[model samples]
Each structure stands twice: as structure tokens, then as C-alpha cells.
Target: MSIITLSPAILDAQADGRGIVALESTIITHGMPWPQNLEMARQVEATVREHGAEPATIAVLDGTLHVGLTDAQLEKLAQAKHVAKLSRADLAVCMAERRTGATTVAATMIAANLASIRIFATGGIGGVHRGAESSFDISADLHELAQTPVTVVAAGAKAILDLPKTLEVLETLGVPVIAYGQDQLPAFWSREAGLRAPLRMDTPEQIARAHRMRAALGLPGGQLIANPIPAEAEIPRDVLAPVIEQANADAARHGISGKALTPYLLQRIFELTQGRSLDANIALVLNNARLAAQIACRMTLLT
Candidate 1:
């Protein structure tokens, strides 16, 4: 059997040379609960379509790597339990074991590149977790950005992480971290992370050109486009800081670490914020989808 299974729509888009934006499925399986996850997935894909690009939501199901999922697949994955959250280190292992798995930013990029998709959209990218000096627990997403050739549009690193350290590591890895239409890097749920971005680009066309130019210059890795959440949907940094601190404290109290930490923090924040954080997440994801679609379209034009 072929390692990859492309959805009919994705195959058609590829045949027609249409713009395609890759989406990660971990947002559906691991980021949220049932119905809301399904709804967000649909809305995000719709946003990509509305912006003149196809959405390829990548995942691995029963040993098959799917470049794009159909509606039925999306529904199944949304409600599926025991889904492995596959990243760079374990994506292939999950496939070999014939397990259903959702792709993280790192795994998604690898699959996206295999499908020749040039852009991806997500709520946020993982980075250096807090207390990493001793834990040394950095996300594979950062290393993937240093090697994969897909431009990723995200709200920025999840706010629960050490933002400054994340930025420092990206710099060391030679990854271009460009804030979109702003000078400040966006926190996952907030418009301002209180850190100046390393670079800034105000237009999708400019971002596309930079992506191509990197390839021309023989640069390895993709660019990180830090797109801010729509202001109307953002939880102001001042308002969210305390809530995040509380959640972090709760996690530390429970000794929650590693893979369990992110989800626990997000869920706690969602509860503490009265569901506002999830709303912000959905808004940011849709916002990123729109920007990624525009960038993908611009890339097609440049091609």
C-alpha cells in the first residue's frame, strides 16, 4: 500500500495546481473536546477555502498517512479516543504500529512537505517549556522549523512556555521568526507577548517572496509567521497573565509534566477564563488559516 493517502479534494487541488494550506490534526484530537473540535476544524477549513486555498488537515490513521482528511475522517478523529499525538520522533513509529494518530506541528510539517504543501496554519507552535534549563524539554517543532521548508503561520508559542527562551532558541537555530503586521510577537491568546519580534512583514506577498528567497539562498528550514489573534477575540495579556500563572501553579502542584502539561494548562485556563481562552484559540486558528491561505496563494503566483 502507498504510504500516503490523499483526499479527493486535495488530489484535485494538486492536479489543478491550486494553493494548498496544511493543517495539523492534533488541534482536533488533543487540543479540545468532541463537538467543538469538529466545529473548529470545519470552520478553519472553510476559512482556508474562503481565502482561495485548499485545506489539507494531516493525520495518520491505521498505518496510512493522510495528507488531507475527508469530513467523515474529521468527525471520526474528533471523537476518537486513545489517539497518539505524533511528533517528529514518533510519527513513523505510530504509522508502523497501525495506530490512529494526530499530527503535531513537527509531524504535520513533515507530512506537508511530503505533499508539497508550502504553508500551514495552527493556533500556536510549541517551544521551550518552562524550567527547561534542567528539564531540557524543548519541542521538536523548533527543530522541524530549522529543517522543513514549509512556512508556518501561528499565533506564536503557547503562552504557558518561556517566551524569551523560545525566541532565543529559534534565533540560535537560524529560523526566521517574522511577526505579521506587527513588531511584537503574539502570545497564543493575546495580541502582545511583550517581546519584540526578530523580523516583521506586513503583507502576504512579502512573506511569500521571503520564503522563496530563502530557498534560493539555500537556507534549510521554514519561516515562522507569528500572526496576532484578532483583537476582538483576544484575551488581553494583562487579563490573562494571572489566569496563566494560576494554571501553571496548579500543574506544578500536581507534578504534571511532559506531554500532559500543555493540555492541562490549556484546560485549566479555559475553565478559569470561563471558556474565553478556547474562543480565543479558535479565533487565532481561523486567523492563521486566512493568512496561510493568502501566503499559499501568493506562493502559487510566484511559481
Candidate 2:
């Protein structure tokens, strides 16, 4: 049996020359619980299709790297217990062990590139964690973007990370941080990070052209398209700053570090914001998926 399995929809889309958008599975397996994850996954796939692309939600199920999940596979994975979170480091290890795994941004990009899928959408990319100078807890997503030739569309790096440090590291990695239709990059749940984006493109066509140009120039890595959340759906940075600070403080107080740090902070923020954070997350993810699909369509047109 082949290690990679494409759903009939993706295979059909490929044959028909339709655009395809790669989606990360961590958003389903690790981002939420129960039926909500299933609903969100369905809605994201539908959004991709509605915008003229097929959605390939990446995961490793029973050691097979599934590029596009069937509804039954999606439901099973959503409810699976002890699913490993696969990044650049452990993705192959999990597969070798024949365990189920959810793909993070890095792992998803690797899978998408292997499958020749050019675009990926997700809520936010992980980055340099806070106090990373001490903990050295930077995320592999940054380095993956430095080498993988797959365009990733995300609202931004999670606001809980050190945004400035993350930006600096991306710069060091020679990644183009392009904000879509805006001057400043987004801050995940918030619309503004107070940091000017390195580049800006206002339309899907321009973004697609840029992607093509990168290949023409033999660029090593992918573009980071920072698609900001719609204004009405965004939580302002001013409103979110204190909540993030409080969350970080709580994590530090509890001596939370490493992988446990992020989820802890996010949960605290969700509680402090009275569940508004998750709502905003859903909105931003949907928004990113829509933009990613548009870009994917333009990508095929350019091809």
C-alpha cells in the first residue's frame, strides 16, 4: 500500500486542474475537543471548496500520511485518543511506530510539499516562545518555512509568543513576512501586532505571482502570507495584550514550560476572555482558509 493517500476529491481536483489547499490537522486534534472540532474541520473544507479549491487536511493515520481525509477518517481522528502532535522532529518517528498523529505547521508543510500541494492554511504558526533565550523553546515551524516550498497562510504567529523575537528569527531565516492588504502584521486573535510587515500584497493574484516568482528565482523556502482577521471579527491588540500578559504570568507562576506552556496560556486566555478567544480563533481560521483558497485558485491560473 502507498504511504500517502489522497481522497477522491483531491485526486479528482488534481486531474481537473483545480486548486488545492493543504490544511493542518493539529487544529482538529489538538486545538479543540469533541464535536466542535469535527464541525470546524467540515466548515474549513467546505470553505475551501466554496472558494474553488479542494482542502487536503494533513494527518498521519495508522502510519499512512493522508493528504486529504475522508469524512469518516476525519471523524475518527477527531475522537482519537493519545494522538501524537507531529512536527519536523517526530513526524517520521510516529509514522515508523504506526501511531496516529496530528500535523503541526511544520509537519503539514513537509507533507504538503511531498504531495506537491502548494498552499496551506491554519489558525496561527508557532514561533519563538516567550523567554526562549533561556528555554530555547523555539518552534520548528519557522525553520520549516525557511526550507519548504509551500506557501503557508495564517493569521499570524500566536500572540502568546514573543512577536518581536519571532519576527527577528524569520528575518534571520530569510522568510518573507507579507501581510495581506495591511501595513502591520496581525497578532493572531488581534488585528494588529504594532509591527510593520516586511512586505504587503493586496490581492490573491499578486500573492500567486509572487509565489511563482520565488520558484523562478529558485527560492528555497515558502512565503508567510499573514492574512489578518476581518475587523469586526478581530479582538483588538489593546484588548488582548493584558490578557496575554496575564496568561504568560500564570504559566510562569505555575512553572509551566516546554510544550505545555502554549496550551496553558491559551486556555487561561480563553477563560479570562470568557470564551471569546476561541470564537475569535474560529473566525480567523475561517478567514485564512478563504484567503488561502483564493490564493490557491490564482496559483493554478498562473500555472
Candidate 3:
């Protein structure tokens, strides 16, 4: 049985050798509430199209792994309750069980690779959780970046996580952490995370070249492009720090752990910031989507 399905738009793009940027479905399924999630999904896809790239939003539906979702499929997935968040470990199992699932960063990278899409855009990647040294709760997204060959563009690791520790783990894994247009890594909602980026690239062509160079050198894993949120959209690191700390404390108080921790922290931050966090998140996501499209287009030209 054929397990992979491509939307008509993506199929046409592939046939025409046009650029295609892969997007994760969890942003729709797990990142926001119903109507907003659906609206964001549509807007992000439109952004990709406007930038001359096709958007392939990956997900699993009724035992089929879809490389791109139709408008109806995206709407249904956004509104569906309790969708399984599939990561590296359970992506295949979810498909095998004929269950509908939203792909996280790791699973999305896996699917993007399977479909020959070399670039993925997301709001942020998960990383070393706070107290990971004791809790051993690092996100699989980090490991996926260490092995998957698709370039991932995000603001950075979620701010609720331990940013320095996340960068340390990425360094240990030998992944290239490139900050776009700046020397500092970006926090999810903030332009500056107060950590120095190991590499810096100012243009999409440069990033695309770096990605190809890695493949030429036979390197495992992909690059992490820390694209900063627009200045007006950023919440500023100092302002977000206390908010994150409070949210983390709340999570610990409520005994939230594992997959539940991220959503809980994000929701709390949204409330704590009076909806500013979600606004920043949407802005950053759209920014990353535009950059991912540019990179994908550059890669297509290189190929």
C-alpha cells in the first residue's frame, strides 16, 4: 500500500521543479486554538506562495503520510481535538495504526526528507528542557537535527527551555547553529536570547550554499537558522525572562512534564503577556516561513 500522499499543488510544483518549503502540522494542531490555528495555517501557506515557493505541510491522516495538505484537510486537522503529536519515535507507529497525527519538528524533518524537501519552517524548535540534567527530558527535536539532513529555520529554541543548555547540546551534537543577519541567537518571542551564535549568515544564498556544502562534505544532520523576529514584534529578552520563569514555575507546580510541558508553558506565557507572546509567535513564524521560501528557492536554483 502506498503510504505517502502529495497534494495536487505540491505534485505540480515537484513536476515543474519549483521550490517547495515543508511546514510542520503541529503548529496547526497543537500550537493554537481552532479558528486561529486554521487562519495561521492558511496565512503561512500564502506567505510561502507569495515568496515563489510551494508549501508542503506534512501530517499523517488515516494511515497516509501526506507531504502537503489540502485546504479542507488543513482546516479539519486544525479543528480536530486531541490530535496525536508525532515525533521521531512514534511517527511510524501513528501511521501504522491508521491514526491522524500532527508532525513535530523531528517527525516533520523525517517526512520532509522522505519527500525530498530540503527546508522546513517552524515557529521554534524544542530543546533541552529546564532541569534536563536531572529530569533527562531533552526534546527529540534536538536529536533529529543532529541526524536529519533537512535545513530547519526557526526563531530558536522555545524560550521556556534552558537556552544556554540547548546551545550546548547542539554544539555537542555538531550541528551548525547559524544566526540569520546577526551574531546572537534569537529567543522564540525575542530578537536576542543573550547567547552568541556560533555562525552567522546574512543571505539566503549563503545559507543555501552552506547546506549544500555540508552535503558535499558528507556531514550528518542539518543547519539551524536562528532567524530573528522583527524588532517591532519582539518582546525583548529581559521582559520575556521573568515571564518564562513564572511559566516554568507554574508548570513545576502543576507537575507538568514531557510533551505536556511545552504547550502548558506557551499557554501560560500567552496569558502572562496578555496575548503578546502569541502575537510575537505568529510574527516570527511568518518571518521564518518567508526565509524558508527564499532558501528553498535558492536551493532549487543550485540544483
lDDT of 2 at 211: 91
By the TM-score metric, which is better: model 1 or model 2?
1
lDDT of 3 by residue, 1-303 (tens): 789998999999999999999999998988887788999999999999999999999999987999999999998898888689999889999999999999999999999999989999999999999899899999999999999999999999998888999999999999999999999999889989999999999999999999999999999999999999999999998998899899998999999999999988989998999999888889999999999999999998996
What Cα-based lDDT does every candidate model obtain?
0.95, 0.93, 0.94
TM-score of 2: 0.98
- Greater-TM-score candidate between 2 and 3: 3
Worst 10 residues of 2 by lDDT: 258-267
Tens-digit lDDT string for candidate 1 (45-122):
999999999999999999899999999999999999999999999998998989899999999999999999989999
Please list the residue runs of candidate 1 whose C-alpha ends up more than 4 Å from where it truly belongs after superposition: none
TM-score attained by model 3: 0.99
- Residue 2 error, candidate 2, Å: 2.4
lDDT score at residue 172, model 1, on the 0-100 scale: 100
Q: Could you estimate the TM-score for every candidate? A: 0.99, 0.98, 0.99
